[model samples]
Target: MSKQELPIIDASGPGTACCAPLACKPLSETEAAELAPLFKAIADPVRLRLLSLIACHEGGETCVCDLTAAFDLTPPTISHHLKVLKQAGLIDSERRGTWVYYWINPEVLTRMSALISPASPAPTGTA
Candidate 1:
């Protein structure tokens, strides 16, 4: 009988797609496709700034009217960007009586932070 048998053939070991070495765990193809549009939505500086403002606001949310005033673009232009954020699942909007309110999706932000987090600090030259 071979020393190595069914246990050796298990794919659920360390550094595997099914197990340990957490970062090495592969993202499914479908997940990558779904995340592409979300990253694309955040690629623009304007969108990032807008999101920051809304996220940092006193109420943790902002009305569309208040949001437009801070931008040089027309209200419709701001609305368009907000719409993209909404579609990307990075934000959510609610109609409060008349005006609409927008807020950040903290879960999405957390995932993005994890995705872009540096693996290690750069080495110091003169140590």
Candidate 2:
């Protein structure tokens, strides 16, 4: 199968948060459409854990073999979860020798975090 290029979020660029914080402003239809798939991809319990494992792995990357051992499901099931994370642009993978190595895409995570992060509190006036 051909490798798919994951979406890259430019967190450092101006107005690159993908959307304003959830409580700060309502999302435009286009923004919601673009962001919903990412949330959907990670909504599954297996995929959520898979994402956490990859992000927390030492050196920020891990092989498919390592991930499989953490779950009671078969390797294929783990692979499927990885694929969902990959397709959501949450994680990236590369085939190294006999195993596929995966790592989190930090920019996407940053954008997601920024979107959901609480807005800063208003400053209080001193009497």
Best candidate, lDDT: 2
lDDT of 2 by residue, 5-120 (tens): 43422234434433345766677676677778888988998888888898899999998988999999998888888888887878888898887899998877777776775554
RMSD (CA, Å), candidate 2 to true, equals 4.5
After TM-score superposition, what is the CA distance of residue 75 in candidate 1 from its true location, in Å? Answer: 1.1
Q: Which residue ranges in model 1 land beyond 4 Å of their true spot?
A: 1-28, 120-127
lDDT of 1 by residue, 25-112 (tens): 4556655666567689889987988898899999888998888888899988898999888877788888989989999887666555
Candidate 2 off by > 4 Å:
1-19, 121-127
Show the lowest summed lDDT stretch of 10 residues, model 2.
118-127
Query: Residue 30 CA error for candidate 1 (Å)?
Result: 3.1
lDDT of each: 0.67, 0.74
Model 2 residue 1 lDDT score: 46
Model 1 pairs in collision: none
